[model samples]
Target: MTNENRFNFNDALLTALFGTPSRKNTIDRLGIVCPVFPDEELRKSAVILCERIKKMDDFSWTALCKMAK
Candidate 1:
């Protein structure tokens, strides 16, 4: 996919995986006004996130976001 498309996909995926956090909580915890994927660091972070998610027992959004970071 194109870079734009990939970024869009990643954003959607993260939103779905993490649900929609309360606006204030999200900003405080993640420092993101909206859901986003790591771009320049995608290669390294994606691999780690995927592996961590796969091993998670609960498969929760919070878990996924933690892993993604």
Candidate 2:
């Protein structure tokens, strides 16, 4: 598949962290900032996301998109 169509772990983490791509308003509505949580809190969140990333090889574009919500 072309790079544009690829869905990887990094993309999932970003979506989970930053919310939907190119939907700044939605993110704003959700109150998700770059550092949504404090560093210590974020590290705890990262642990959960890391487990998710390890369990899945990749995700469909639609699945990644849902991560935004």
Against the hidden reference, what TM-scores do the models get? 0.30, 0.34
- How many steric clashes between backbone atoms does each model show? 0, 0
lDDT of 2: 0.46
Tell me model 1's lDDT, rounded to 2 decimals.
0.42
Per-residue C-alpha lDDT of model 2 across residues 1-69, encoded as one tens digit per residue = 556334456445655655443343334423444345556655454444434444443343336557545
Tens-digit per-residue lDDT, 42-61, candidate 1: 43434443444444455464
> Which ten-residue region of model 2 has the weakest summed lDDT?
21-30
Error of 1 at 8 (Å): 18
Q: What overall lDDT goes with each candidate model? A: 0.42, 0.46
Error of 1 at 26 (Å): 21
Highest TM-score against the true fold, candidate: 2
